[model samples]
Target: MLQIQELVFDAWGRRFFDGASVSIPKDAKVGLVGRNGVGKSTLFKLILGQLTIGGGEIRLPKQARIGSVDQEHPATPVTLLDTVLEADVERARLLSDLETAPPERMGEIYDRLIEIDADRAPSRAAEILSGLGFSNADLARPMAEFSGGWRMRVALAAALFAEPDLLLLDEPTNYLDLEGALWLEARLRKYPHSAVIISHDREILNNSCDHILHLHDGKLDLYVGGYDSFETQRAEKLRLQEATRAKIEAQRAHMQAFVDRFRYKESKARQAQSRLKMIAKLPVISAVLREHTAPFLLPSPERPLAPPLLRLEGVSVGYGGPPILKNLNLRLDLDDRIGLLGVNGAGKSTFAKLVAGALEAESGEMVRSARLRAGWFHQHQIEALDPTDTPLDIIRRIMPEASEAQRRSRLAQFGLGVAKAETTVADLSGGERARLLLNLVAMEAPHLLILDEPTNHLDIDSRRALLDALNDYEGAVILITHDRSLMELVADRLWLAADGTIKPFEGDMEDYARYVVDRARAAARAPSQVAREEPPPPPRAEPPRKAKTPTGPARRRAEAAEAALARATEALAAIDQALLDPDVFAKDPAKAADLGRRREAAQARLAAAEAEWLEAAEAYEAVKEA
Candidate 1:
């Protein structure tokens, strides 16, 4: 369905695709795998015509439709169900044409609509939305009422509903919870059209994809079967390559030695010359370079904590209003590895906070050993990092009594080398920032570790490294993540947060996945029963959003803030691109240092611009509300 021949693309002072070529079979689900800095996303853009190729060609059928979710769906007045149903352009057009068409044309339109199963579009769209964590009530809600993240889900739902010939998804599971991720995995496996997904989630790649497309060192290698099979195939191919190169090198060396030994002899002169020529014609094989994954440092506690380190009896907790988690009775031992499962907004973070001592229980009894120490690491910690702050700066603050050398050494142990130690957080990749925070949180060797969505930013290899570190660390763990593979491998038991309470899950990860899929399917079927009881309202009859715009000072401030944010964002991207150069630090340390300083300044500007934008936007919304 999709083909690329010697495709070449270069931008931002580097080559992303250097004669990279691959073919995707029709209706094949392929996973694009690569390191963080690799050009997987760029490949998607090139295929989408958002980026021009420097050479060669990318080909698809003449009328092939391509679909991708570039950003969140726009906030509008359309009902969620109608928004997705409208994604079927052909169906929408035919239905619209039926309003004013002649009798002959009306028959054609109706026939086409029937062919496309237009009547079932609503049910299908609702199923997609339900699998993505939207409730049945959300179907009738205006798009303007949802948050940005929810809108992104709606965009994904639209793409899936349309079922274009070729679908491109970049980290589709990033915005989804574990339940949603599970549903998506099963959905992708049965997708009728071809799909190319860029995802670091192992379970998705293994379960959803039929093939793996690996991007490495400016080349693409297509492997048959899932991620595990791809790994095995790649390893064997490298081994064969190395063996061939060694044999060729030995032949060349022997020929050269023969030429050197017999060049002066009269009888052997012709033979020597012939050997030299033969040696010159020998093929040159480059050595394969294996990529390295930096190790994560998670130290174990100096002394083991007492068993039952934490116990809760009828514990209830909440911010101020009703309790998000009520009457929770649980116990944590020194050696337990507990996997916490829940959907978004399901009190998982609240439970983590309560255990981390960031929150106090509102009622009931909660007990903890006096010397118990807990290390909490969540995705929010990475978001809350100061853009201008460097690993060096952060380490210095934490180790005030230590010397500069000690601080640098500590940062190094956390996988931040000398070059990255002084670089600002804004210049670091998501994986780097995640690694720094993960190690920092576990630096003191707490008896218990509470990790939430820890693998969201990490690549497959980095995630494996983290899994290894977690396994080696001799401490109790409470792991909350959407990554099924990691959770299954790390956790010895399972706990689920649902229905405003926490309880022990009866079965394993596989059972949980089945349950989630079944639940979503049941929810999707529920809306139809309700429709039978009461007449369904037309989506178009729903109220539209109020058409109000900010005026005078509010409008002016918002426009200025938006402009400033654009400038700041562009400046930061340029600096980030420069810093991403592989030889930036090696070839010109001085230039790298200058870029680092500029990036720090740019980050500060970006932060200020974002804050101003948020304030202005809120004020403008307030005016509209008034």
Candidate 2:
């Protein structure tokens, strides 16, 4: 357990926190949330002792451990496992040294080894590494060989493997694939240690955290539950706070009027003075507004175009292989809100590029409607922005015909005020750049929008703004995003690119997720059939064991075969009953149908069991005759 008491942090002459106090209980999963530049990361550093607190104290229990993963990593030649295992190298070394020490020194060294080994065990290390989605092969690979994303995972694995009493993870899921992210969520849910994590992914926070900690304007705001609960509660609180502020202002006005009317009257003067004192003692309630403002805009003209805004006719695209996307024929309707989804390196981006006309298909035609107007936002939009251009200049450059007032209004709609619009694009943060790009794209009024990982570097509010704008836009959207919640919010259809094939999913994300889970479960159970096909284990070895009642082994074997046959028959019957259950049948028709077929197969298996039983019986009888 860790407690931060009256902690204050300041950076670059700006106060991030002023006497913010919070306690992280044992095994607590806490989400640190706030708008960008609100010092979530700075607070994390204070907890980890990386930065000195300006005032007050951060208390940790004696012998408490802490781990943190930052946004950057130092370049090192260490392997992934090497970096992780280094957490307890001293303990491991002590144990190793004790193993070879002389007998005369063994007693003292053995005690020391026990003391050191208690803090870290090899099994625990392996479990943490596996839980973080690092394979044995990955652990052996050099850290320098991995991408920045994988290196981030390496850092995360190191933190998790340390088994710290308190863990501070900063955007831990930023670079993870969907599967890795899910694995981390499950691991953190079951983690015995406490954690404070800052992440933009809503689903991760919702599924993993028990509490929400909102950092706003140098104040720590605590919420009882996860992200959704915090949002709902925070909204209500803001509403109430606004109402209270309004009432307080109204009372102050009435008091001022009474003072103005009664200041000259001696009898009323005392009452007026009392009212003044009361007003002075009253706590000033400054209403803290939500960071994001609702975007005000009329829906753009949605002129109906012909069907198939863009069509990929037998498109094949890849770098240097058979093809990452091979001979894919796909069509996008004007009303389609398609989400591009796949694992890393599965060509989701490549498919998006083909659709956007940014890259050419290797062997097939990418056709678009003659009237189609397209806007594309790539993942690296920040890098794509002109460094010399200010946000205002960029807008002017993109839309030469737009008046200054129109440009200012467009910028304001994306949360960029007049002052911020004057700031250079080079100086903006990743989230700001994303917002600017969104604003620029909105002004173009394209009939089709192609965004490749638009939510890549956006915070929660920026993502919400983008999603809202996209939802309200009447354009066909091809969105490639790793944010599952964002996809669910904006995507009306799912397109899965896997193993060089594009599969269309006609249902919502929940249904797609269920289908994926079922497939994964089916794959996991595939080996069960092979195990079942193998012969049973050999009879237990015995050195001429005395048979019960002097019975021969053959008779015992016949009884064992009959028992096995009866067990199989009973199992088949149970399966039949389960398949016929109305609730089960209704909830999952496919599972029920599969089970029904399995029942027929089980009947055949039962018949085979009976045949085997009869053969065993015959063989036993022959043995007895001999």
Candidate 3:
């Protein structure tokens, strides 16, 4: 368990979190919810001891273990199993040493070895990897071979394999597909350790977290239950706050009127002074709540789309090989909210590009309706932006017809202040760049919007804003995203791209997920039937066993290695504990430096033990199999 007391974080003379205090209960699953730029990730980093707090304290219990997914993992040519097992390398070394220990000292080390092995179980690592959608065969695959999404999975597996008492996850599900996201949700819901997750996926937060911490306007507001419940309660609380403010204003006005009338009277002078003091003591109500300023503006269509916005006839799209989308025929009508779903490396993006006219199909004809003007928003389209142009300049260029006031107003709607808008496009964050692209596209007022992974870099608020805009738009939308909740909210029909075909399903995203899960199950079961029909491999000849026992000096050397490995394992555990100590890293930078040095020392020891263990194991195996 951990508690943050009067925490304040400031940067460049601006306060991000001001006097925020909250407690994380033991084994509790908590969600950090807020708009973009409200410091959700900042708060997570503060708790993880990755950021220094400007004021107050973060109190964590002693000897607690913590694990987190690094936002960026180095592209190393290590195997997936090697990366995950790296979480507790010293423990693995210790286990190998125990396995090769002499029988005489086994009695002395047995109890300690049992305790260490229980804390570092390889089966737990395997289970976490499998649950996160990795196959047994994938364990030996190099990490460098995986894409960004799969690499994120590897990072998550490493965190989970550490088996920390508290896990701090920042946007953990950003790269996860629906299947992997669901698996993670299930795991977190029943997880024994506590977790504080900062995620934009509403479904994940709702399904996995029991409590919600809403950080808004430099304050932390705690709520019981998940996202949906939090929404309901927050709305009620805001309503009451508004009502109280109104009553206070009325009373203040009445009292002011009384004072104005009686100030001239000598007999009522003392009473008037008392009323003035009482009125001054009254709390000042905020003129506008943060939620009131939210952008509810929807995208307005400049012209009505024709009956059929887009039509594909006998479309065959592919690369150098055979067609991935073969003979696809479909018509997209105006006001259609179509959700495109498929597995990784499928033709979803290809189909989207073909529809957007960004790519030419291998064969067949495509048609766009006469009145259908299209605006395309791709995940990588930010590269098209001029790095020299500021966000404000880009907006002005894109919407040249708009006045200066209108450009600034629109930019502010997407969470960019006047100062931030003046910053160069090259200096903007990934999320900021995405929002700018969206703003540009929205200003075009096209009759059809083609978005491929538009939610990639957006936080929860920006996503909701985009979703709301898409939902209210009078134009047709063809969206390709892995976010199921966004699909459910904004999509009316499902278009599944798989097996070199684009199949249409008439249902919501929930139904689509269910259909996919059922199909995956059926597909998984088919391999067993084929295996049963095939003949098994022939048995190999047995190897001869070893006859002699170990010598005295060899036994002593093994015992010494085992003792060193045990010490290394303990040091690794200490490093894990140090990583979670916010007081050390946030309050005392020197202590953090010392902890880092010790961690490096422990890692060196672990590597040495691993080398010794491998050499000893090789020798033992050669003798036993001789």
Candidate 4:
């Protein structure tokens, strides 16, 4: 059993875990969850004894072995299969000794090899690699040849082959395709050892773990069951906590009022004293307020966008090699909401790039409306931003005629306030840069929006906000994400891109999930698997995503519009507070004029933000229900 008692960790002047406690049974699988910066990874390091704890006791069986995926991979000429098989230290060491040892010790080395099951190590590593979407040819390839994403898969395979007593995996699926992710989840389930995982993928957490561990607000909580169970129970628990706090506050208010009224009166002094004592005896309940997620309010299309804004006929695109998506006929309109599903390396990103005009088809007709302005949010675009350029600089260059107010308004729309707008791109976090990129495209008022794995770097709150914003969008959207919740909430229809075919899927996300599971099972049971252990030539690119039934839009614009208004109102309120501050005005006798200038600038932006909300709402309401 693993026990964490009074675990207190302090770093960067913040108490991450203060007197927090949680215990896992001898062989329990735990899903550790928290906000992005909430120390989930830190906790793993603490358990591994790689970092010193501020205070606490972590008790583990002294004889138990631990294995984890490496965060960084050093460049190595070693083949991938050898790298994974080497994870079995005993086998590797014993085999090395056998090569140099005298004949007298031959029997001893053979005995050790037999004991450690060295003969099966290669096959085991091969099976794990194949499951992670690696071809047999990849097994002999040097580790340095693969990209960082594929390298992580090799890391996971090594960890799995190690077969530790306690396995720790942090975001294992972050780099994996859906097929690979599903394969990994099944392996973890069948794992005989204890495991602790940290992931934002809900399906993995739900399916792989029998217990969920949540760390938030400087505390740790362990709940029985999977991710779904944790969410449902946690929601109810929070609701009850809020209700309880409300009642306590009401009682406290009444008692305080009675005491305030009678405390100074001579006749009521005795009664007031008694009331004050009673208040002291009452249990205090701090407000159980849910932390707010980052605000992300996307703008609606103002232009009159026609249906079928983009059409691809017999289009085929890939990265230099043969086409991954071939002979495709697709049409997208302003009102269409599509979610793309596929395995990793299946060309979902390639398809999106083709649609966005970033990459031309090898040989096909591309028809697009003259007025088509597509807003694309892809990781590569975020990467392409000039590090030295500030948010204002980028916007100013793109829209040279835009005024100071217009530039600031556009930046603020994606949650970049005055300070962030002035900061350079190099200093921004991945999520912040993503928002900036999104704002840059949104300013163009695109008729079609394409998002490829937009939620990969975003937090849960930002993801929720993004989903809400996408649903409220009047323009067409093609979304490719691994987040099932986002797909379920935003995608009205499903499109499956697999086996070099792009076609509409005739089911929901749930059905698609079933299909994935079934496919995984079929692959696991396939014969001729042993033949795959040997090197095979490069094969066809993996298949991509699936589509779902469209959920007709309702008054979603109202919610998103309100969110936009709230953010605008908050920005205006900050300006008002700054303008009203005596300290700010007193900084110089001439500061009042400066303050007035700032206020005027802010008011113009506020007006623009308001105008956008009203216009979007009007357009949303005008859509006739068919």
Off by over 4 Å in 2: 71-77, 88-91, 98-137, 246-256, 288-290, 294-301, 364-366, 403-406, 505-626
Error of 4 at 206 (Å): 2.7
Task: Please provide, for model 2 over 227-279, each residue's C-alpha lDDT reduced to its tens digit, 9 standing for 90 to 100.
Answer: 99999999789867876786687678778889989988999999999989878
lDDT tens string, model 3, 1-626?
A: 87988888998668998898888888889998887678888877887788999899998889888888876455688887778888775566666768888988667566765776755355566566655656566667788888777888888878876768889898777676655666677678877898889887888779889999899888888788999899989977876677668668767887898899998899999989989998998888776466532453446676675456777778898776888788777777765677777665567878877887777788888887766667888877887777888978877777789899998888888678888889988888888888777767766677777887787777776777777666557777788776768877666567766667676755555655555444334324442222211111222222121332323223324445666787788778768766775756775699799888988988998989977766665565554454
Structural similarity to truth (TM-score) of each candidate? 0.84, 0.74, 0.73, 0.76
Mind giving the per-residue lDDT tens digits that candidate 1 earns over 475-526?
Answer: 8899999899999878877888877877778778898888777766666677
C-alpha root-mean-square deviation, candidate 3: 24.4
TM-score for candidate 2, residues paired by index: 0.74
Model 3 ranges off by over 4 Å: 88-94, 99-137, 248-288, 292-308, 311-314, 327-329, 364-372, 399-421, 442-444, 505-508, 512-626
Error of model 3, residue 212, in angstroms: 0.8
Indicate which candidate wins on lDDT: 1
- The 10-residue segment of model 3 with minimum total lDDT is 530-539
Choose 1 or 2, whichever is better by TM-score: 1
Worst 10 residues of 4 by lDDT: 533-542
* lDDT value, residue 282 of candidate 3: 84
| lDDT (tens digit, per residue) of candidate 4 on 279-310 | 89988766776776656656777875654587
Residue 583 error for model 1, in Å?
41
Task: State the C-alpha lDDT per candidate.
Answer: 0.88, 0.72, 0.73, 0.77
